[model samples]
Target: MAIRVQLTERQAAAREEYESFTRQAVAPHADAWDRAERLPEEFLEEFAARGLLGAAVPAGYGGAELDPITFGLLNEELGRGCSSVRSLVTVHGMASYAVARWGGDRQREHWLPRFATGGAIGAFALTEPGAGSDVKALRTTARRTDDGFRLTGQKRWITFGQRADVYLLFARLDGREAAFLVPRDAPGLTVRPVTGMLGTKASMLAELSLVDCLVAPEALLGRPGFGLAAVAASALELGRYSVAWGCVGLAQACLDASLDHADRRETFGVRLRDHQLVQRMIADMATGTAAARLLCQQAGWLRQDRSTESLHATWLAKYHASRTAFRSASDAVQVHGAQGCGDGHPVQRYLRDAKVMEIIEGSTELQQTTIAESAYHSRTRTTPTERVTA
Candidate 1:
């Protein structure tokens, strides 16, 4: 087991700090929050005040201004504690990053500060009732009005939708897709809460109905046609990276829980770990977690370099890490046996959340297609000299 990469001392320290805080504050309440189907506003406010929620915000905006790896570290720790909290941060980053990268001056000045300080919570609205995993099929309409734009459409599966103060929404305007910043208070917009979700129960997911919702002309995030290809893609790139790291955290959590259960629980007059089958499962969980972490680290560094190859790297990381989480969580439940199946057990929640991870930020099936296509093109582009046999 040679080391392929190493974290700097500063990075290690930062990760430890985040882990410590999450263990004390967030992890203890994850299951309870999930059962309640809501996350406390005060908890999110505290997170924002600590600058954990504003990883993408710059120093000028009164934020922590963390780098990609550090940002990933923050997300990882949060996921380890509670994925619902992590999802909130991920969705908020999508909205905040969009504004920072493409928003007009006024949009930036108004939104970034609020986003950093938690004066406003943000959510991304791209998944519509008929159009998820495929943004081109979106039917949301953006009609031009003299005073502003009139948006009419329904968005579904919006995380933090019930509580988000603003949404980074998308609509088709004259055959061109565009992005907009629609405040929660916008007239003709209605929010319908979605409960009984299989995972991330505290995420406050909701459906949004916009019936001729009017917004200022400045609401457009970028010029016409920049919605999917530019702004949404940019935000989703960060999202994939964040999700990849978060999955690593979830897998690790599963591994830790499984190990503890196996060590203490005795069956057939022996500890669970004494069984060969149980040992094999633990081995798989441990190795899978390590692989996921390695992939996430690779993705994080590529993101830091702003490399074109980073896109596929992120997809690869996300695909692998999410599966790792699902598998590990399943094994954790098996190790815990009856205890794991019981309500209020963290492993049960972990399994459910891990399944959800496989679907979001691009499903496992979608990533496979995209990665395969990228690999084919990459092999064709590489010089023969660059290929070496092991």
Candidate 2:
């Protein structure tokens, strides 16, 4: 079945340009980056040169002003080349989007142009050692001062943490959640690099500690009590959109790898493609990919339309696509047999990368719970007249 999302000519061109950039730049460096476990500085500049970074930011802020769906398309293409590159897209785009949407004039003037040009790397610091899914469990605190706020807390598993020039740091202010912009050179701030990630090797995951990190009043994002809600809504929207598209790319990669291996490998004097089980795997992969892609695109369209159902659709897309990507990557690895487990193979990387997708942004179990709770609330909140008399 053909995918039915309508793409404007401009969007189509953007996608093609993204694909071309990935093929020429990111794809060629995947192995080297994985081996080094560091993203090359030059690559970031290349992304900026291509106008790929901060593509979703408004034109007034020096961005392309593209919609989220277009950004997703770009992410999918980048993921097809390398998951790390896709992750960079997610983190940068998400942080920039948050700033653009909720940031005040000063915040916009300070970060937007730098982000669009890749001059400033932004990281979202929300996940703490003690708090994963529960935002209320966050222990990071900020005390209001005469001049500004003094922040103290630790943020772990922060993507681009070590390399971020500025952090969108979330902390508790007077027992309420608040977010502040902390520069890397801020006093009493430290970032330590974390290792041993299954995928996204090039991304510099780190743990950040802030001991009386002073932030000016102008550094606050949105309102004091609304930080958690604002960040949650923004992050989940971007996470789901990016992950959904990344899953589609992963599925496509898996399909291509499996097909290639099956066509070349022989079993009992026949190609592996001739086997019924092999064909079934390919069919399943294709079906799952199509379903996930459609859900993702639908969510994106809803977001563009400013529909209330966008959040529900976003959760659905993330949950479904993460599962699909994991399954497809695992199956692809199985299809490749011993060769798949070998170091430096794209399938192995895909398998690792796919697993991380399930955990980041929000876990699969978390999304499932969100979906179920949403359904339950919807049913309970229905008007008596609207309720069926079964």
Candidate 3:
């Protein structure tokens, strides 16, 4: 069944274009990409050709310059085709947003155009071995040099780390956290593939070792001592929102796949869809998928206006959508029974991909804590104000 969310004419057109593009360019090869454990490099060019590579970037920089709703739709459509492909947008957009938001004019002029055209692939590298969620605990260091900075650190779980032409790397400078734009070919820099993933196997995650990696003085993004907070405020917020929409697509995909199987496959006396138990599973999948999509749409609207409540809205959306996607995928496997467990079946891939969604960007536990803290503060603040007014 088609979703009924309202959209403006522009957003509707953009969404339709994305859907048509993914159906033709992505759906057919999604399984092959998963099985190969890699997204073909050629697809990046295809994304550039379709103007999906830079959905959030400004057109002045040669990007599509889409609005937040349209950007969310792009990710949703890509997510429906494959989670791995959606991840490409997540990391790349994170890097692009970082540069566009924090970089100096010279920096922006140099990198944004390249990112827009697929001339330079970008990856955000803030997660370290000891600092997955805790950015303050990062051991990466950037020491001042006569000409610039020499960075030394190791970053783990960096998506597209090996293949990316540039990385938005975080490190400590003079005891303050800072962000740097590091080129892949910098001396002493090493990007190694991290094999054996639970999901998103084709996202091309890597472990980066920066041993005295040198960068020019102009490579610093934003002023020193502000990088971590800037990333948390902007890049991470955008990331959670994007992930929520992607999860919506994931759940929707599970629902569509499950419904198709239930309608056709038969057992005992009639079609599987005729069985009451099968109908219950189908209903649950459909409801969860729709609910997740609605939450994501609400969050997308809040983001469009840059509302103060957008952060909490995004947290709620991501938390609910990711959990729903996982549950739906699990139930989908149950609906398909033995057929779902086979290597070639799409459900088997969906099962693996769903679990990773819970952990990436932010874990489920993290989202719960964030939501609770926001609610607690809001209630406490309002209580005192109401008492005084009364």
Which structure among the candidates has the greatest TM-score?
A: 1
Greater TM-score among 2 and 3 belongs to 3
Error of 3 at 109 (Å): 0.2
Clashing residue pairs in candidate 1 (N, C-alpha, C atoms within 3 angstroms) = none
Report how far off residue 69 is in candidate 2 (Å).
1.8
Model 3 per-residue lDDT at 140:
97
lDDT of each: 0.90, 0.85, 0.86
Model 3 agreement with the true structure over 161-251: per-residue lDDT tens digits: 8679999998999999988899999887999998778888888899999999999999888876764687646888778888888888888
Q: Ten consecutive residues with minimal summed lDDT in candidate 3?
A: 1-10
Q: lDDT for model 2, on a 0 to 1 scale? A: 0.85
lDDT of 2 at 26: 84
Candidate 3, position 49, lDDT? 73
* CA RMSD (A), model 1: 1.8
Best by lDDT: 1
* Candidate ordering by lDDT (highest first): 1, 3, 2
TM-score of 3: 0.95
**lDDT (tens digit, per residue) of candidate 1 on 67-103:** 8888888889889889999999899999989999998
Q: Can you write out model 2's per-residue Cα lDDT over 1-390, one digit (the tens) per residue?
A: 123498889889988988888789887788788878889888888788877776767899888877868877887888888888888878877788888988989999999999888889888888999997887898999998998889998999998897899988888888889888888998889899988887888888999999998878888888878655876577657866887788888777788889999999998999999999989988888899889888888888888888888888888888898899899999999889999999998889889989998998889999998899998988887777788752
